[model samples]
Target: KVQESARVSGILHDIGKLVLLEFPDFFKKAKLNKQGRITQDSEYAVLGTSHSEIGGYLLGMWGLPNEIVEAITFHHRPSIQISTKPDLLTVLHTANGLANMCLMEMESDFGTYLDMKYLDAIGVSGYLDEWLSITHQVLDNTDNDQVQT
Candidate 1:
């Protein structure tokens, strides 16, 4: 039950990124250079809304569970007062951090910062290796299956 909410939270975590597509200049400015680097300014600054908040707003509009909505909205700042325990938000926080780290290495234009305090608050300090391993395994599984398609 809780895990399901967490999964949903993860899926909806980036819902705000969709809005960035609406502004070509902002979206293009958010892109990384050929070498995959960005300056202090982010594309979101131009769009005027962060992905977390945008995702939360959309989820709320969709009539998702309050917990799910909170998890999606506050995953970036789990310390904020929400109705549920830190579990679902923690999962999302960690997943988002790991995903951001991966994208950073890939030179993705994603400009969000992964808050270390969120990881600590979620008690996920030691699980990074396992999380990354699982992520790679899932990616490999999908890649392998792609050949079949």
Candidate 2:
């Protein structure tokens, strides 16, 4: 169950971007000054909606589970999500940040590559090292045979 949740969360995390690109008219007036990088403020100001919100709404309409929808909705800044207990959304947010830190180099609108505040809020800040260690172990074990395409 945990593995499936992680898989679904990973697959749907950036689905909002697809929603935005598929419906350009919705963001037709959105400015390109930010190089199409839509942070919370920029997206709300220019497009009148963020991709996260759109994706969440679409997923809900499509009858996806609430946990998955919520995770995708607040994946960017889990601190903004309501709820004290750690949930799938929290995991997604942490994983998303870690993945971003590993993969992206471009200067982002939001300050840090990861949201430590969110991690701290969920009381998992102390476990980050363990997570990273596992991440490194996984990467070290991967082989070219893992790539299908």
Largest lDDT belongs to which candidate?
A: 2
Clashes of 1: 0
List the global CA lDDT of all models: 0.63, 0.69
Task: State in Å the error of residue 48, model 2.
Answer: 2.4
Q: How displaced is residue 11 in candidate 2, in Å?
A: 0.4
Report the lDDT tens digits of candidate 2 across residue range 1-149: 86787779778777778867776665666655433444566678867778788888889899988889988888876778776778888788767665444334332322364577777776887877676656446645765344210
Which window of ten consecutive residues has the lowest lDDT sum in model 2? 102-111
TM-score for candidate 1: 0.68
lDDT of 1 by residue, 48-147 (tens): 5566777888889989998788777776666664423347777777677656555445423222444555555556656666776675566556644332
- Cα deviation of 9, candidate 1, in Å: 1.8
Error of 2 at 96 (Å): 0.7
Evaluated at residue 142, the lDDT of candidate 1 is 61
